[model samples]
Target: MPEKSYPMTAEGKEKLEAELKNLKVVKRPEVIERIKVARSYGDLSENSEYDAAKDEQSHLEDRINVVEEMLKYAQVVDATSIDPDEVAVGKTVTYTEVGETDSETYTIVGSDESDPLNGKISNDSPIAQAILGKKKGQKVTIATPGGKFDAIIDKVED
Candidate 1:
């Protein structure tokens, strides 16, 4: 199967790249050093230090592979190009739900950058999908675990 591309902001991409570099250059070397020191303790079977180091090394390698794969298929979505009326990645959308008097705000972003508590939501999410391509004053309804609720487009911003 082909690798799936990830929608990411430039800053989000930089953060991932930084983590990859740290794992490859800094963490990798540090783990190697630890392994070396642990090996000096004698037989590997009874050495808890050696076993722990080996487990850490395995985890580091797995992280490196995951990061590399993410970078390999990254589809950078620039926040600046997003339209004010369209629900695109990196844009903040304002809406009012049915049966609720107050309005709410949420930023449409990549899945990696999404933090519901922080008001950032993945563009591929059901809520975002419900609002995409909609303009101000348009109503959208989406199915959620809480049941279907209607939302009216109030505003969009980047």
Candidate 2:
């Protein structure tokens, strides 16, 4: 099978690595121990604790596998290389809505690193696609859940 590629920032990769380590080193062992104890307690079919522990072990292993795959195909993105004058992944951009006059700020990141609540948006997102390669003072139309609206790029920063 082809290994999937992951486009992620260094910080994001580190976070994922930490989670993987936790799952493998801590959670996996803890769940196995729980299952062993539960097995000693009672009959297999009627033991809810054993069932729950087994489920937890499955989930933990699944997470470990996912993280390993992501690590294998990880692509690190550096925030410093992006041009301050252009919209690109790893760039922090500020914009103002055309008619609403409200200003918004967001950091363009890879799909794996996007966290909307923290103002980090995926480069593949509609808004990012509309703004990519655009410069300050350039207007762009974005189709959002709220509705289609226009925005003007105010500034681009690291």
Candidate 3:
């Protein structure tokens, strides 16, 4: 089976790289020092500090591995390469729901970079999936976990 690809913007990939670097160069060493300090407390079985440090290290290593894998399979999508009026990953899309006067704008990004509160949505999300590859002024029906809604694409920008 083929490995799953992590589609993201170049900026997102850079962010991941930076995170990976920090994890390896800073966090990893810090965790090691913590473990060393905890070890000095003696009694590994009952040492709360050692247990906490080990747990933190485990979580950190897991994050490092996940970030590494994402970097390894990253497929950077250049918004400039896509049509200016078309919605796609790395592009900001503005849309208005049918019968609603308010317009919401969101940048479509990869799952790793999704932050709904900041207006960055995952391309895999129902709204993004419905609008992706669609041109401005297009009407699309998005089927989200909550329900389905009709929306009109108002704009697409890099």
Candidate 4:
């Protein structure tokens, strides 16, 4: 089977790289030091600190591995290359509900950088999927797990 591609914006790639560097240079040493301190606590069998440190090390290593893999397959997307009037990854889209007066805006981003609370949504998300490739002023119906709704594209900024 082929490896899955991880699409992301340049900013997202930078964030991932920074995280990976920190993990290897800073967190790794901290964990090692923690293990050494835990070892000095005597019996490993009865030392809770030692067990906790080992568990933390395991989780940290797992995270580092995942980040490394993601970086290896990352495909940085350039928003400027895409049409400014179209909705696509790395573009911020503003839309209004078909029957509502209020408007909402969200930036379409890769899964690794998606933060719905901050208005960044994953391309795989129902709303993003439905609106991707659509032009500004186009209307789209998005069917999410919560329900379905219609939205009119008001703007698309790269």
**Each prediction's TM-score against the native?**
0.88, 0.87, 0.96, 0.95
Model 1, 76-98: lDDT tens digits are 98767766687777778899997
Which predicted model would earn the best TM-score?
A: 3
lDDT of 3 by residue, 16-103 (tens): 9999999999999999999999999998999999999999999999999999999999999999998899998999999999999999
Model 2, TM vs. native:
0.87
Candidate 3: where are CA atoms >4 Å away? Answer: none
List per-prediction Cα lDDT, in the order shown. 0.86, 0.87, 0.95, 0.94
Give lDDT tens digits, candidate 2, residues 14-81: 98989988888888889989999999998989999999999998888887888898898988877577
Clashing pairs for model 3 are: none
Error of 3 at 66 (Å): 0.4
Native-to-model Cα distance after best TM-score fit, residue 126 in candidate 3, in Å: 1.5
List runs of model 1 lying over 4 Å from the truth.
1-3
Deviation (Å) of 34 in candidate 3 = 0.8
Model 2 CA lDDT for position 13: 90
| Candidate ordering by TM-score (highest first) | 3, 4, 1, 2
